[model samples]
Target chain A: MIGRLNHVAIAVLDMEEALKVYRDTLGGIVSDKVAQPDHGVSTVFVELPNTKIELLEPLGENSPINKFLERNTQGGIHHICYEVDDIIAARDQLVANGARILGDGEPKIGAHGKPVLFLHPKDFLGTLTELEQA
Target chain B: MIGRLNHVAIAVLDMEEALKVYRDTLGGIVSDKVAQPDHGVSTVFVELPNTKIELLEPLGENSPINKFLERNTQGGIHHICYEVDDIIAARDQLVANGARILGDGEPKIGAHGKPVLFLHPKDFLGTLTELEQA
Candidate 1:
């Protein structure tokens, strides 16, 4: 069952500049930062009163974030994360219902060290759906 | 500074079937419902442990939700909302920075009885942004 929202993920071209906007402009405080070499990106988060906002920048050319930034994506909203008690169960249900899982076989550790998985945008229409076990 | 996220809005075709997915299938509890004649949407909400998920179905053909559904859009993610203390200031800042507001002059009372406004997806690439005052 989904519990709550974990965080909203936003892709950015320049992590530093985005940080300034989230921090200085928006008056949000940086809560955490991590570099996931395997995921090929570095991420930073700002804690809000109720939830968190995550900013991601791809590290290299082959990284997904890099390609997303290369396309000159504009800044706005991104993926909406649903907090779930059992990510594996939710993933299974989604798969059983014909949804595509972004992770290989199981839920992977996400930016905030939560078990997270993405549903293929094609299966979810144009929206990117994320299931997070918190 | 903004507060916690109030809700995430999903544009769906059938409010009843969507409610089934969110309630019976997802094991969620419907927390609220509202019909906004001005917005031309009848919304139902399922409250999670952490945040609320809203389903929006347009009331008629002229409603934006109707046109969105008529496109046979797939089921997926939608807008990410930020909770703010001052909707007017946030809306003004967003407008000053070249963002377009869906609300004409002021934030309108949304389905949940909160003041809300939307930013055009074209202004923010393909992503829709919402500002909610709680």
Candidate 2:
């Protein structure tokens, strides 16, 4: 089951501009940008008290975030991540309950350096949901 | 700034079906359904360790959820709520920083019976951002 709201990922056309909004405008402490090549994103974390906001800019044209930006034009909320105590147990439980795990049905190292898997947006209403190992 | 993530709101066509996904499928503990007439939506809260998931179904045709569900068809993430120490201060700061607040630029009594205000999606990279008084 889900433990806590890990972070909400936002796709942005420009990371520097988005950084200005969260850091300069909203006064959120921003983390140093990190390239997540496997995930095809360059990410920066906006630290909040209880959770973090992940700013994602596409690493390449083939990146999933690029596709999202293509549709939204202005970029948008990409996904919401929830932390789970056990990634494998949660995966099996969700799969047993008819929830589909995305990709190869295996966990991948995510932006937080934790095992993460994505659930289909269709199954979770319209929002793409991600589960991360706590 | 933000205190914590209050909840992530998902707009669904049918509350029961959405409930099944979060409650039965994902093994989340859900709250009883409540009709928020003023907000023009019916909501149910799925409690997690650190935050809550708010499931919203349009109460009427004019409801905002109705519009989102119409576009997404299968429903999706509507908005995310972040708790603020002072809603008024947060609003003022955001506005001064060129972020446009939706509605009347005033706070409304939200589902949690706290003052809440929404920021335009355009300014926040297409994510409808909600700020609630913590």
Candidate 3:
């Protein structure tokens, strides 16, 4: 079951401009941009009192967010992540409920070094969802 | 300054289908649908430990999300709301920092009964942002 609302990832064309809005303009506690080449994105965390907003930038030529950026030229909200207690059990339950999981239905070590699985957007009301083990 | 992430609003075409994904599939604590005709949408809250996800369904022909749903077809993330201590001060600061406020540049009573203002998506890295009075 989903426990906490993890982070909302926004794919941006420019990380510096995104930082200006979230960090300087909104006055949020923002983390420095960290490149996750393995994940194919550069990430910046805007920490709030209750949750964090993740600003993601395409890293390389085949970056995962490149397609998203192409579709949404101005950038956009990419996915919402929810924390689950037991990822395997959660995946099983979701599968049993006719939910589609992305990437062979296997949990991968996510950016935070936690087991994470992505759910199909069509199955989730067109919202790309990521379930991270809490 | 932003205090907390008030909620992330997802606009869905079908409330029933959206409920099936968030309530049954994800096992989130879902609230009963509350129709806010005044706001032109029906809302359902998926309460997480730290924050909430608001599912919004169009209520009337002139619903604000109607255009968004038309473009997205299925559904999508509508906006992200952040709580602020003083909305006027926040708006003034944001305006001074070259952020454009939507509509008449005045705070309107949001669905949560708090004074809220929407920022131009173009000015916020394409993310529709709402600032609510905390």
Against the true structure, whose DockQ is highest?
3
Name the TM-score of candidate 2.
0.96
Clashing pairs in 1: A3-B49, A50-B4
Task: Point out the higher-scoring one by DockQ: 1 or 3.
Answer: 3
Q: In candidate 2, which residue ranges exceed 4 Å CA deviation?
A: none
Model 1 lDDT, full chain set = 0.71
* Local error of candidate 2 at residue B104 (angstroms): 1.6
What stretches of model 1 exceed 4 Å from their correct place? A66-72, A93-99, A121-126, B31-33, B66-72, B89-102, B119-127
Candidate 2 lDDT: 0.88
Query: Candidate 3 chain B: minimum summed lDDT over ten consecutive residues — where?
Result: B19-28
Model 3, CA-based lDDT: 0.92
Ranking of models by TM-score: 3, 2, 1
**Candidate 3 error regions (>4 Å):** none
Best by lDDT: 3
DockQ for all candidate structures vs. native: 0.44, 0.78, 0.88
Per-residue lDDT of A4 in model 2: 86
lDDT of 3 by residue, A26-55 (tens): 888999899999999999999888988999
Q: Write the residue-wise lDDT of candidate 1 on B16-82 in tens digits.
A: 7676667765667895567777878887887877777778877765886665566547543456577
* Model 3 chain A lDDT-worst window of ten: A17-26
